[model samples]
Target: MLRRNFIAARDLEAELEQWQERIDIIRHKLKFIRQLPGVACIEQLNPPGTAGGRIPALVEIAGGTAIASEENGLLFPPDIVILMLPGKSIEESLREIGSLLEQPWFAESPALKNNRIYVTDCREYFQLPGPGMIDSLEILAEIINAGDFHFGFEGLGWIKFESGSPKNG
Candidate 1:
């Protein structure tokens, strides 16, 4: 109120009120998203696929702090991606995931037979190894996404994706 052209107190108060309302709405939306079935800790997307475009990085999902330790600034590139296992039923969940993912592959290898091997269709087959071999999962391949994943395994410790190269030596 010092200067006539500065601004009116009423107008300033009304603007502040509108901003507060918008902030409240955004906060509610974020809370709702957090309560979703498979909410993840993703910051951004590389946008390679169509359906499942909003995927999180392995380091982000696994709670890894160092992102630069990986090959590049990211654990997986646009072609190579990571997912959050926020739910169970790997196969059913995979089908639920959209096409932002390419060359769908499990985190486990094909050595161990009893892990996840099934063939609903005669043309396609799948076989996954145990969790101990999960460290050898594909680097370029995308990670399956889930916010509330529940896998029946011997051990399931979250590992940082900043340890090694994309391929094993």
Candidate 2:
């Protein structure tokens, strides 16, 4: 049976309201590229050198669709590639990703050709199901509509592949 929902505190309402405000701001910044054209995102947790992985739920929340693993062989090209690694520092993760990018398949993928690769720390962002989910949504929104927004990644825990370093603004 489906469980009923409950609101335990007034502060929860306030927190939600704050999240909504942040979402609205992000949505506004992403209005131009609301939906990535032919976007296909994959989330690999604790990648190559490590173990454990899962689909990223934030894709839908960020307004993009997630390509099922079963269909990996069917797509001609995906417009985006997202690497979600928990616990690893940005440098280590990037090194792993750089190797992956060198593979024939990944090198030819449209996501790389168009420079749409992104990386993030799952521990600080998308690993679990929680209220903090909104942060990942916002980060993806910012990344997807990057061209339109021309903004920095400062506080966001995610990074675009091309930037090579975290943004301070």
Question: Backbone clashes per model, in order?
Answer: 9, 0
Flag regions of model 1 displaced more than 4 Å: 1-4, 35-169
Candidate of highest TM-score: 2
Query: Model 1, residue 54: displacement in angstroms?
Result: 22
> Quick one: RMSD of model 1?
17.9
The alpha-carbon lDDT assigned to residue 95 of candidate 2 equals: 71
Per-model TM against the reference: 0.22, 0.66
Top model number, lDDT = 2
lDDT of 2 by residue, 1-169 (tens): 9999887789788988988887677656546654554344434432222222323445554556565433223144556776666655456577777555654456566676777777766666655554656766666666666654333543356677773333334
- Residue by residue across 120-158, what tens digits does model 1's lDDT show? 110111112332222212211112222222232212322
